[model samples]
Target: MLRLHDSAQGRVVDVVPRVEGRFSMYVCGPTVDNVPHIGHGRFTLAWDVLRRWLTFGGLDVTYVSNVTDIDDKIIAAAARAGRPEVEVAAEYEAMWWEAMAGLGVLRPDHAPHATAYIGQMVAMIEVLLAAGHAYRIDDGVYFDTSSVPDYGLLAGQPLDSLRAGTRVEPNDQKRSPLDFALWKAAKPDEPRWDAPFGAGRPGWHTECVAMSLELLGENFDLHSGGQDLKFPHHENERAQAVALGKGFSRYWVHNGWVEVEGVKMSSSLNNFTSLTDLLARADQRAYRLLLLRAHYRAPIEVTPETVADAERALERLDAVARRFRLEPLDESIPVRRSDHPEIEAAGDDVRAFVAAVDDDLDTPRAVALLYDLATKANALADGGDTEAGHAAAHLLAVLAGSLGLFLRGTDATLDAASSALASARDEARRRGDFAEADRLRDELVTLGFVVEDTAAGTRIRRA
Candidate 1:
């Protein structure tokens, strides 16, 4: 059983306890107005890990994530670029796919775009209107919060307080301050689609509600996004579903924001860092490790120093994985690490690590536990304790797999960098620079190779 906290209910619940073989999950995707930042990378990778862990545990998972192609931001971007709406959305959406693939994110099972799901969004809004939960005002349709008695229940904000504290721009066409737009009327020279409410476009909050219902039905296993989305965005999403008089989601997972140098990362504050820019300076492995260094729920502070630390940490992890000739443990073996006394001593710590991961994905704690196991495993390997060494390697691989940090033996690509280094050494030796050649030979061996200057030739192994 997985314990997941429903942000709506503010309590943890068993997500798939009684389910048979399949699980459904929905995550809020990018809006496609701008390039994604390192903060978005954190949520994307974390959810990808969660999906992998559940699948590894023997559940068939069907994941659906939506792309919000039609939004005010997209409209603004189009105007700024002097381009058509579809052109702007298409360009940015392509960039999104490229960036995510570069970071090793598995494409979602169903990536429904808002423009593609306009019919569903319209139908859902029509249902809300027919159910007397929404009203079509002069030039727009707005969800009437008064109709839903449990308004603000999802976010735990009092309705009275929300009404008082809410700020509205000059052009908001709503009957009440608490009411939110379901569809906005078209403006001159703006991107517009013909909806039931004349020529207009779908509101931001309605896309996820409709897409989730269309793909996963009324209720799904999980709904995930950033912590900042909890208030108005997700809060309004739940209200739209409950207005249909049915359950929506069982669990809501929100990852905390990434901070920079002790301040919240934001474009307005000029403290933001783009993932693409960071990737230029660091490899994908190092970029991911920086985010995984902190727990998902805690605010992560990103700095050049922090990124450098993550690079060193990832190198250490790769060094250990390289040392072990890892193979998948047999399912029939019961995966018993307790029989070995060394592993038995580490059992409590291992259990704690798994528990933290299972308990809302405490990745930082799990990472610490992994480093501890690595130290013990290295010591055992040096002492020639095969049984204990194998046990430690097995446990470390399992934990590392949960973080998407392990390199399986089957998937090891030829190290082009290493091959290039060897060629460079051969060239140096041919040029009679014996001093440089000798330094390169030592460097190659230190990098997990058995470089031999013999009559036969140089060789490499699992050093």
Candidate 2:
């Protein structure tokens, strides 16, 4: 059983899906008006890890992450670039996916874009208008916050309390200061869609309300996003769904922040570091490992010292793989963490690793458990406890794979000649021709490859 920190409950609770064995999850994807930043990377990796683990735990999962391809930001960027809004959206969206691929994020089961769902957005807004949950203004249609009594649920504040600090003043058309736009009427040179209310676009908040329900259905098992979205964005999205007399999400999960020099990295703050720049210079796996080495809910600081440390940790994982000639965990097939026969044979470590991650994704401890397993495997194999060492290595791989860390022996693949030489050396060792095996090993070492023999077989890695 996985216990996640449900933002709605403000406590850790077990995720019991309405339909047994199948989990429906919706994560708010990027509004790609610019290059991806470190914060974007963290949010994606956090939910990605959660999604991967759910499948790893043998649960059927339908994960839906959307793209806000048409937004105020995207429109603005397009205007600045002297291009069509769709072109700007498409360009950045491409960059977004390219960056996500570099970070090893799995593609969503369905990626519904806002532009494609304009019809659905209009229909949902009509339902709200008919239900008297929304009203139209000179600028556009606005959701009547007063209609939904419990509107600020995800924001963790009461409507009255939140409205007290509301900024929507001097707007006489709106009934209350807390009222938000459900649709924005077109301005000069901006995109527009026909709606009964007017020819305009859907507000940012309205986009997810329609997309999530239309794709995943009413009352999906989980709706997740970063902590920054818990406020007005998520709260407003929840309100629209509730106003239409539909259940939106059973659980709301929010991941923590990423910090730099002790301040939150955010575009609004103008302090975000680009994800592309970081990935270009640092090991992508190291960044993933760095995220995993911290409690998923804790703020992670990406300094040279931390990233260099994560790289060293990744080396240990690669060492185990090389020592055992371990086949890499394929990202395509996510199975139960202990499916490996060797891992199942190792008592308790698998269970302990699963427990740590299952407890609200306590990845810091989960990573520490992996290090412990790696240490045990290395020491046992060195001390001639081959069987136990194999089990520990398998356990480590299982845990790492659950978190999407596929450990490869090396990035360097051997050429045909080197492969043949390695095979000949294996044959020589089997024939008790130790002298010949040593000669081949030296040849490989001279070619910048590290070679080792285990009880299972000989392993090779690039030096």
CA RMSD of all predictions: 5.6, 3.8
lDDT of 2 by residue, 1-463 (tens): 7999999999999989978989999999999899999889999999989999998887888999989988898888998999998888889889999999999888899998988899999999999999999998899999998888888888788888987887666588888878889899999788999889999999999889888998889889999998988998899999898888898899999888999899888898888888898888777888899999887778889877787888888988988876765777776666565466656656687788888988999888999989898899999988999877877787788779888888877556678888888899999999999999999999999999888776656667676
| Whole-structure CA lDDT of model 1 | 0.76
Clashes of each: 0, 0
What RMSD does model 2 have?
A: 3.8
Q: Considering every candidate listed, which one attains the maximal lDDT? A: 2
lDDT of 2 at 89: 86
For each candidate, what TM-score against the reference?
A: 0.84, 0.90
CA-lDDT, candidates in order: 0.76, 0.87
Reference-based lDDT, residue 289, model 2: 96
Q: What does the lDDT come to for candidate 2?
A: 0.87
- Which residue pairs collide, candidate 2? none
Q: Model 2 Cα displacement at 46 (Å)?
A: 0.5
